[model samples]
Target: MRFKLQTDYALRALVYMAAKQGENCTTDEIAGYFQISAAHLGRVIRRLQNHGYVKAIRGRRGGVRLDRDPESVNLGEVVEVLEEGAQPLDPPTGEPGNGVDDALRLKAVLRRAHGLFVNYLNKVTLAELVAEGLPEPQPAQQPSEESAPAEPQPTVAAEPEVASSPEKTPEPVGAPSAAPGYGRPGSPTYGGY
Candidate 1:
């Protein structure tokens, strides 16, 4: 039902690389573009390199590059590999067969659900994800002389708009304390970054 942080980071980094069309990029570049921590992304990049999904180049003009073609990299395969050992249902704590039939059945169901999720992702590739297009990088803002030091003016605050339906409502900044299936920040369940 939920992916680990590594999985999310890997997918995001891959998509960014795929969009670049084989151009090499630094971990900090990708992290900055996504507004994520470069340190965390660096670890993810190392994992990706170890898996042969990417290669690292050392030198002033070097950076990480996708080793495989975007079309050949399956999203499902990436997720399944990165999410290995992440179980929705933890193993029974007590002795086996100690009123655990229901738990066993639930584990089987969860496995099947996870399989379905991967199956859906298998139909998509990194190339397809990049084909959707990414947002353009924002340029740094510079103050202009015309906008310099204006006199303060009193203004009335406008009321916030209320949506008629929950679906129409905008999500609050920083999300909720814990997302539906995600854990709270800094917790083990917290999706990495």
Candidate 2:
């Protein structure tokens, strides 16, 4: 299911703050980095501030900082808070039968699916989201001036190492080859493709 733009912005801002390690950041800074409108981000920040997830400071050298620990911020809870009153499927109305029952059943299934989705999100925390270091900012490249050519260094060729058994190489016991957050090979959740 798709989330509202404001919900998406709120999550992005939180992730940025989490990666910043408690450093205060301005809305303009975040908006500029994300290439979004500062005014829209400001509204999202205000909502976050009202929810006590972010604290806004006033005056000089003022900015917003995360008010709570990253570990305490559950992704599901954040989504729920930011998406309050948002209905994924409209409630079925009118008398029973005549396709109304089918709509009601579909709504129920959607509700259950949404609950499962949120449950999965609950397993993830803000800290986990930012456990990896932030991406390095790219600097603008400058044009190089024409200069004298330099000689290239000499290269050495090496033979590739060969396994003792050509048919198959032995893998370490209990070693995980799959990426994190994904099911292991042979598991039900594993996407073999």
Candidate 3:
């Protein structure tokens, strides 16, 4: 099934933003990038901004940024928002005889098909879709002591590499845990990772 042109442009913008880093995107930039009309794209940007997907900054060099993480933005929800009143078939409205029952059955089949389509789309996140083309390469992260052990310790019975069983090394102490209510509500870091 085909989406409206507006939805297509919005998806393109979303994917482009997902592939970018740091700098916000300008409507002119998006228009230039896609070779679409700036005015038409302006409307699309406004619609996306209204839906909490993009946020516009006001200034001379101002531009829009992806407000929510790509993974959190569901494709089905995006389609739903963009295609609110544009269903493929009219729903089953109760009416007697004359192939109306057939219409109802077709509508039911369409609904099931749509359900399956949306479920499949929901399973595939935007992050997964854009992973192959992330704008910049991120630095490799160092594994933390809290997350994993420093090194593998060979057992005494399986003496393959080591001559003797070495003494266990102590794990480095981690930062102190936040005290009760220390990082609770009213903190700047609240709701942050």
Comparing 2 with 3 on TM-score, the higher-scoring candidate is 2
| lDDT of each residue in 83-177, candidate 3, tens digit only | 78466696656656978889988888887888887777677555654664422211222224336754865444333344356855433334223
| Candidate number achieving the greatest lDDT relative to the actual structure | 2
Clashing pairs in 1: none
Instruction: Give one digit per residue, the lDDT tens place, for model 1 in 28-76.
Output: 9998887667888899899999889998888998999899999999988
Q: What local lDDT score does residue 135 receive in model 3, on the 0 to 100 scale?
A: 22
Q: Write the per-residue lDDT of candidate 2 for residues 1-193, one digit (tens) a residue.
A: 6667788678778878888887889999887776666798899999999999999988788899889999999988999998894666988888897889999999989988898978887887778767743322322121131133446655544444567768655444454553443223434333221
Best by TM-score: 2
Model 3 clashing residue pairs (backbone): none
**In model 3, which regions exceed 4 Å deviation?**
92-95, 134-193
TM-score, candidate number 1: 0.66
A best-first ranking of the candidates according to their lDDT comes to 2, 1, 3
